[model samples]
Target: MDFWILAIRIIFLVQNTTGIPGNFSLLFYYLIVYQKECILKPTDLILMHQMAANTLIILSAGVPQTMAVWGLKQFLNHLECELILSIQRFGRSMSICTTCLLSIFQAMTISSRKFCWKDHIVKAVKYIGCYISLIWVLYILINFIFCVYALIKMDNKNVTRDFGYCSIIENDKIIEILYAALVMCPEFFFSVLIAWSSGFMIVILYRHKQRVQHTMSTHGSSRNSPEFRATQNILALMSTFLAFYTLSSISRGCIALLYNHSWWLMIVNQFISLSFPSFGPFVLMNHYSNISGHILVWIRNKIHFILF
Candidate 1:
């Protein structure tokens, strides 16, 4: 194996084990394990469903690559390749849909009290489950031809190869332009939504922080309630998650554009690819105080129990 190929495998392995599933698990633990006493809200369910989708995204990409790279398994033929390619295509399609749902959900949640949508949030949220599922099926269908093409004869090493993940055929400049358009369009939209939602989150938290500081400095009552504190923390966490996603994607895009087959450049790209998934859990842990504390204590206690 080439050194860079070997390095890329190592990078992706770490990413698969931790970055991808860890984030989903964090959210899973919060929704199913920790917060079971509370009735699950529609938004919570939607977000958790999205988390599930995110987890699937990692599995679809990582499993095939891991198997291929480690030589633990082999496709041996195009039939197996089709299955893997289809799965990855589905995962990515679902991720795009979920992201849109997340942004719209956030928008609904943040609507003005007097807005027409405010009253609809509760009722409409109840239907997100069905809607998201519908979108998943639709996405699968849309990507069917694309995935099948991977299993077909293609000169593009990126999409059809031993690499487990395939790339688009660079030979087709028209398709390349289309691919770039597809990537940049969604990225641009998501960037805007993330920025818009983050602006709200930051402003709210900033004002709350000012209020707290004023209360402390001027001897006012510490009126910041537990719920408010928790809410603020969640907002901060969401903001960080968006920021990490944005930066990682930007880095990936730049590298793709600038990649010149240099070892060092390849290493840097491998590192970013490896590190991308880890950001999700990091953002979550940084934002949610209760969950973060619980997980830390849980891990420490587990370690101590094992040792003693």
Candidate 2:
């Protein structure tokens, strides 16, 4: 039974690793090369970095877990395990980095028009220095020490007892509260921000939809046309982020409420941590018409070229 479950997980891990880059590759082909007007904007680069980061995360974090659960103990104790552990730590740090990027990206996107930071983010061609700096310092100080320990003691089955993630849960509830604030407070605020932004855009879109309907007095307006589609696609990305974040957050909160180190419970919680990263690519790709088109075309061509 465990083997079958492990098999399923391995399949999923491969699909996600393959599928995400596949999405990114298609995006790159269309977005960078094919689309004549598609300038390599800062957001584009952010997303490119994000895709690369996720690939690294999966390579490091996802694969090792699969190996462990599949009971590949030899692989677990071997050099591969150490590499996996190190890469996993790297990925965790990068995950925090990407997360802050997502939050800051959306926060700046939804910042009040009068906020002074708005222009800074907009003109932040080089970097968003303050936010980036704070995030880097916080992540390193928290994760760096424990990460080294995790690498050192990775192969030992006692690691679950040896190392606690970020020391967030075990040592101090107050600390957990603070970390959760650092994470979910921003998440909550940004959830509201994205919702507000989407709502504002929706009003504009609805009016346009109505205006088009009234003017043409038939099918809906060109609001549903490609540009509007892209707008809604961005909205969906926001929604997906919020949804997965909210769910994981709820699970995290539940853990805090009753975190007694139940093995099965912790197992579930560990799995819960996965959804935001694993499901993210599909969430991003599934909604966007433009990226989806590239993926579909790429797959079709690959199939045809191979078959022929």
Which model scores highest in TM-score? 1
Runs in model 1 deviating more than 4 A are 1-11, 20-24, 27-39, 64-76, 96-100, 107-117, 149-184, 215-219, 223-237, 251-276, 285-308
lDDT of 2 by residue, 126-147 (tens): 5654454565466555545544
Extract clashing residue pairs from model 1.
158-166, 158-167, 159-166, 159-167
* Per-residue accuracy of model 1 over 21-131 as CA lDDT, tens digit each: 676667755654435457555545555655665576566666556665665545535555556546654654455456556655665565434257866777667677688
| Model 2 misplaced stretches (Cα beyond 4 Å) | 1-20, 23-39, 73-142, 145-188, 218-227, 259-264, 267-272, 287-308
Q: Give residue 247's error in model 1 in angstroms.
A: 4.2
For model 1 the TM-score comes to 0.67
Which candidate ranks first by lDDT, i.e. highest?
1
- Backbone atom clashes (below 3 Å) for every candidate: 4, 0
